[model samples]
Structure formats: C-alpha cells, structure tokens
Target: MQKAQRLLDLAALLLRAAEPVSWREIQEQFPEDYGGSEEAAIRKFERDKAELLELGIPVRWLQGDEDLPAGYLIDKDDFYLPDLKLPPEDLALLYLSGSAALAGGDFPYARDLAHALEKLSFAARGPGASEAAGQAARTLSAGDGPGRGEVPSMLEELSRAIAAQKRVHLVYAGAERSETTERDVDPYGLYQAGGAWFLCGHCHLRGAVRTFHLARIRSLEVNRAQPRSRDFQVPPDFSVADLATREAWEYAVHPPERARVRLDGPVSAEDRASFGPRAELREEPGGATVELTVTNGEALLRHVLALGDRAELLAPVRLRRRAGTILSELARRVR
Candidate 1:
C-alpha cells in the first residue's frame, strides 16, 4: 500500500502543470525519494485527492473527451487546499478540547481557539447543537492535569522577542538554588515538551543559545539598546524531542558513542515516554538501561532532575561528577 504525500507538495505540482493533467502527469511529479510504480502512484493519488477534497480543494473528474479517455486533474485555481483550517467535522472536537482547557483555567490560548471554533461551528451546526457541545466538553476535562502551567505565556514572550529581534533580561532561579541570577539574552526561539517551556537564546553570560527554563525565570524585561541581528539564524542540529527527555541524561548531539544509563523501576515509564524514541533500552535486573548520545549538558541535567532518585548514569566519568554535584546541592537544600 502507498501513503499519500502532504497536500502542499501536490498543490505545488498541480500549479506548475501547463494543461489539464492525467494520472500519469501527476505520477511524474512524485519525487524519486517516494518509491512507487505508476499504478502504485495512482492509488496514492486517489488517497491524496480524497484528503485534499475533504479539506475543500477543488479536485474533480473533468468531463471526458469523445476520444480515448484521460483521467482527472485538479482545477487550476482550486488545485491547492486553502490555508490550514479545521473542517466542520473537526470543529466539534476542537470545541470539546477547548472547553476543557477553559474549565481548567490553564490554557489561555484555548479561549482564542474556542472563539475560532464558534465561528466555524455556527456555520456548520444546527440550533441548540452548541449547547450539547459545551456539556460534552465539560465532561471530557473532568480529571485535573497536574502538568506545569505558565508555559504557554512564556513561549509567547520568547516568540515575540524572536520576531522583533529583541534582547530580554531575566532573573533565573534554578530548582535547588536559593538566589536568582540575571541573564541578558539574544532570544532565538521557543520550544516545548511535556508541558514545559524552553527559551533558546544567546545567553550573554554563556555566549550561546543555551536553553533556559521558563519556570526558572523569576523576572523579565526587554533591552532597548542591544537589538537582535536580522541575519541571526538558529542552527539545525537540535530539536524539541531531543532536548526534553526523562532519563538520567538526554540530548541530540552525537557523541563518540551514546552514553548509557540504568534506571530503576519506578520512573521507567516516565523515562520511556520522553527518551524512548532515541533510546536503545535493554532490560536489566531491577529495571531498564537506556543509551543515548548527548551534547546539551542542560537537557541532560533536566532529565536527571526528572528521575530524582530512580536514574543512574552508567558510563562517562564527567556525568557522574555532575550528578554528584547536583545530588550534593539537593541534599543540602532538603535537610
């Protein structure tokens, strides 16, 4: 079976075609990277057409010639799917989720998403239908979410700074630390995982876009004199999933060999959920051992903090030393 491509690619192909295209014409646009024969291509095309049609792209069967018949082509003007908009069918789901977010008072963005849903739902729904949607939404969010809050607003602030090429100064207080340290930043971008916000920025102190925790930001202000450069671009070497994991250590930069860690039973599921995609895990006596290469010391530290007592870094003498430092500080703070 063949999987259809993203509609954006198909739209670009269709727009470039000179005339009404047959199935073969569409097939030619398939990149060599996508392995499929003409017949296989047609199957994928049909699926793609269906998906596009669902999203309101005007792909249809053209009236046939009296001569030997040809297949369909997308309408020239309507070949592309409109901007990303949830269909009427999806609006119901969005309302339910948004309603829950509103009830919890955690996600402020939910109010905006809900308003957008209301506009769509009004057009699609019948009378009294919206009332039912509200009730269903309430039921879905009955359980409380213990996940960290304030992440969304922090991401918003970082995003603004990145767009405006602005510098921001903030006081960061670490999990175990008593005092706050002020850092001036060249804001690069924001990223998220597991309900946490990370500000990727050139920390004036560190002289790099070292990831900073939104939770640790005790105070914030923008610097007016030292604006960001228009040419600044984030490197492609890092990512959200890599920088946020639940093991004793997790990071993306490929090291000489992936550092290995052994985790006890209690935090095994938590560890697996965050780092399992990158981890090569092996079952050990008490729990599981996970292996991964890392470059971001901050991400690794965060992972260690997540496990608290359940994780043990197996190899790399430097990591053990860092772990000792963290534990020593934690010990002092607790007792």
Candidate 2:
C-alpha cells in the first residue's frame, strides 16, 4: 500500500477504536504496510505514529481495557478542535501566512506545515471559513514566484538521526578548509536562520562543539559502529538557539569584544531587537547607536553590510576602516 494511504487508514482505525487497539490488530489491518518480523512492524508503526502526530492527530499508546493489550488510539475529544468562530478575514490571513511560508521554503519544518494547515482548515467551522481559506490560498498562489528548489535530502536524513540520537559520519567542506575531511558527529540539534540550515553538534575530529552549515556537508552516513543507546548525549540545558546566535555572531561570541554600530536615522524597535540581549541601545534625536559584543568579526561585518546605508560600524576603528575599504571596492565594481 502507498504510504499516504496507509497513514490515512491508520488514522481512521485509531480514531474509530473505542479501546486501545493492540499492535497485533494494527499489523493485521494493514498487513501490506506493516508486514514482516515483529521488529519491522514496530519500526513501521513508530514512523507512522510520528507522521500522525505531525498531522495533529493524537495517536497515543496506553494501557488497554480488560481483554485488550496496551496499544494506540486517538482521543477524539482532544483530537478534534472546538469551533474557533474566526471571521473570514482572519481565516484568510491564516491561510495566506501558511501559503507564504510554504512558498518561502526556508523553514526547517516546512514539509509538515502543509499537513498542519490542512488540519487547521478542517477545524475552522466558523462562518465563511471555507470561502476565507479558499480566497487566501488563491491570492497567495497568484502572487508566488517560481517555486524554490526542494530541500536537500541530507537535511531529512539528519533530522531522523537527531531524533534517533544516532551518531553520523560526514565529509565536510568548510569554507576555509582546502579539502573535505571526514568526522564523526553527535548531533545535538538543528537550526534554520537567514535562509540556511545549520547542525550543531560535538565533532570527534575537532574535539569541540561546532556548528556546521548543512550545505557544506559533502556527504553523510550513520555511524553504525557505535551502539545507538550508547551514543553521545546532548546536555539537558544545551540550547540550539543560543549556540546558533553566538556561532552566527548574532550575539556574543568567544573572546567577546564590544562593537558599536551607528544607525542611520530614527532607529526602530526592530533595530534594537536585532542585536539580542547583549546589546545596549543609546537613543539620540537624529538616530541611535547600538553596542553589542561579537566573537566572529567577519559574520558581524557581513551583517552590518547587509543592512546597507541604514547602519555603520562606529567603534573598533580597525573594523570601521575595513568596512570602508569594502564599500570602496563595491563602489568601484558597480561603476
């Protein structure tokens, strides 16, 4: 059976079951989808359950009634949504937002967003919900440009490895490196920012925690030599976002030093928020100055450059000079 059909069947079976259905029953009902050894069936079920959860279907494994063994079922009360009473405009906005994000194609979880939107559309029984959703989707479709290329398959493989806590071996092509090299990595987490995906993990080769751009990974393979259960573990308090911000130089970096940048004029709340918590904002009648610490000078430089004439590097006269030289080179090229 096709995977999509199997998923629908599994959901239907779970939703209709009055008591927890045993694993055996599930296997029997979808023999073509889950047939094989018990272990294979279990793995299949696990993947199906994950897909169901991603679709907003609450598939739960719990203790069964007297004769039934513990298995899976959907709690209809919780699985279904109450009437939202959302006006047509609001529903249209939700549809448009989802459609835009779907078109943007940079979100790490973009693949699941469509499924989520479908569930939301079904739940929205408020007046004019159907018409609102249809209009929103139509408006978005009409405005969208050519669709983005599909995300690399490696991203999906890495996601599974992260979920399974499996160690991976990668041939990485770092920007500064002369040649690609192999390393074993225990992925702590994944992040998406600035339209790129990054994997944060402990690298066996570097003997340090590092963030790797997904595009820079030339190849990836699971390290089967290491027992899955015995693989490296991520610290409970470890934060992917904090690591990303620091590594990306969006926040304080190693051997941090203060950076002061002058905003062109009338700095907005967004301008202040861009520097993260480590920044201090000084407001003036004309504009504003922001002081923040950074570890990666190059990343900071790139960020300031991207802001165009709206911002300028003030402190660290050396960086300011470097920025000036870059701007001059750019001007010459454009001419």
Candidate 3:
C-alpha cells in the first residue's frame, strides 16, 4: 500500500477502535508495511507516528493494566474541532475575509486555507448560511488578479520564522534605492496592505523597527541554530493593528505638519473613523472640517482628490498650491 493510504487506514482504525489498538493488531492490519525484522518494523512504526503527529493527529499510547491491553488510539476530542456555533452573518464575514486573502492566488498556504473554508462551510447550519458564504466567495473571486511569482515562497518562509520566533537574514531591495542591502531581522508579524504583503520586524542594520515589502526581499534565510527553541521574543507592546491601520499620509517621509480638510458631503461614521484618533473635527454649517497631522503631503493630496468634490484641502498653503498644479496637469493630460 502507498504510505498515504497506509497512514489513512491506520488513522481510521485507531479512531474507530473501542479500546486502544494493540501493536499486534496494527501489525496484523498492515503486515506488508509493518512486517519485517523486529527493529525495522518498530522503526517504521515510529516514523509513521511522527508523521501523524506532524499532521496534527496525535496517536497516543496507552499502558496495559491487569484487565486492559497496552495499545494506541487517537483521542476523538483532540482530533476534532469544537463547534464554533457562529451565526450566519459572522460566518459569511469570515468566508469573505478568507476568500479575499486567497483571491489573487498570492497567499502561500492557499490550499490549507481552502480546506479550512470547506470545513467552515460544513459548520454552517443556519438558514441561508451556505448561500451567504457562496455570495461572499463570488464577490471576492471576481476581482482576482494574476498570481504573484515567487512571493508565495518568501511569505511562507517568513511565516515559519515568525511562528518559530527565529531571526531571518535578508537581501532586500529598498523601495527608493537601486542597491540591495543585507540585514538581519527579528520578524514580529506579517500584514497585507494595498494588496501587498509586508514583514514588520526589528532590523539590526537600521537598529530600528521597519517594514519590508515581500516582493522586494530578493533572498532570505531563517536562523537554523537551536531548531527546537525560539531565538527571540516579540516586544510586548508591539501591535500589528497599529501598523495595519496607518494611512499612506501617516508614513514618516517628510517633516510633520498640521493639515486641514473640509468635507462638504455627508460623511459616514466609518469614513470619519478612518482618520486616526489624533484627528480633531469641528462641525460647521452643511459640512465639517478635520485637522490632522500629516507627514506625506502628496498622499494627503491624492486622498482628497479621490474624494472629488466632496472633500477640499483647507490649510497648509503650500500643499493647496501643489494640489492645484497637480489638478492642472491632470486636466492638461485629459485635454
């Protein structure tokens, strides 16, 4: 029998057995695979056991007593996930998020995520649950982009390093520079923004925390020393949420300046909250004015431009003039 078939058969046997299965019973069931010299058979079984453990199926051994025989069995409770009992709406939201992550085929573990979504679909017991999930999947898949070559492997390696708390050495191409530089980083976490994956870590080269775009990582190596032990600890105060929520204008590119914008159209609560907590808002007739600190004036300009007539830059005379020049250039191009 193939190793995969043998493993599956063994798992099924153990899961359904009323009591722990004896070594003799296992040997009898898979004599072709388990039958050999005593040492060889035992080694084979040990290898299979390790593989099972790696697959998250723990095959536990039980000690024989006067009345009970020594054997092995898979604890059902340990193998099966508990019912989450999520409502249909929440399940739909989860399906949407998962589908979005997999849409472009860029995620390294897309197969694993697809399997998880299948399991999640099985758990949808409420009325219209499956329909909701299907709708969400359709919405996300419609916008799928071409696969990102090589980025998947880099992401996978960084994910493993992050989980193992191992530092990584990287050959990175800077966004603003032509030359590539080598750096050692202790990866804190990974996040996706603007459809690109980024690794947030402490860079020994810069002696500070920095974010590296996965596409720009030309090469990398995770520390191999002490394979079973962690090489570093993530700082307690470090939060991926803070980094994920930052807007383009918030990046530290230029000297910080207070900028104001007037919103003429009715703003949704969600839109208002998009401005960080540091923003101050004042309500006026027919609209509101918001003042917030910005470090990238061009980013702020683009944001206002995207909002069209609904938003207007109100302060920092230099940016206002720059916006006008950009608008004029855009008009000239269209004309």
Q: Write the per-residue lDDT of candidate 3 for residues 206-299, one digit (tens) a residue.
A: 9999999998999999999987588888999999879877888999999999999998747767556666677898888888898999998889
Evaluate residue 206 in candidate 1 and report its C-alpha lDDT on the 0 to 100 scale. 81
TM-score ranking of the models:
3, 2, 1
Clashing pairs in 1: 201-209
Ranking by lDDT: 3, 2, 1
lDDT of 1 by residue, 90-150 (tens): 6556556555555544343343444444444544554334754564455345333444345
Off by over 4 Å in 2: 1-74, 79-97, 125-150, 223-232, 247-254, 268-274, 296-312, 317-335
Better of 2 and 3 by lDDT: 3
lDDT of 2 by residue, 243-294 (tens): 7655356544457777899886777687667777777888876888888777
Which number leads on TM-score? 3
Better of 1 and 2 by lDDT: 2
Q: What is the TM-score of each candidate against the true structure?
A: 0.44, 0.65, 0.69
C-alpha positional error of residue 29 in candidate 2 after TM-score superposition, expressed in Å: 10
CA displacement after TM-score superposition, residue 6 of candidate 3 (Å): 8.3
Whose TM-score is higher: candidate 2's or candidate 3's? 3
lDDT at 38, model 2: 81
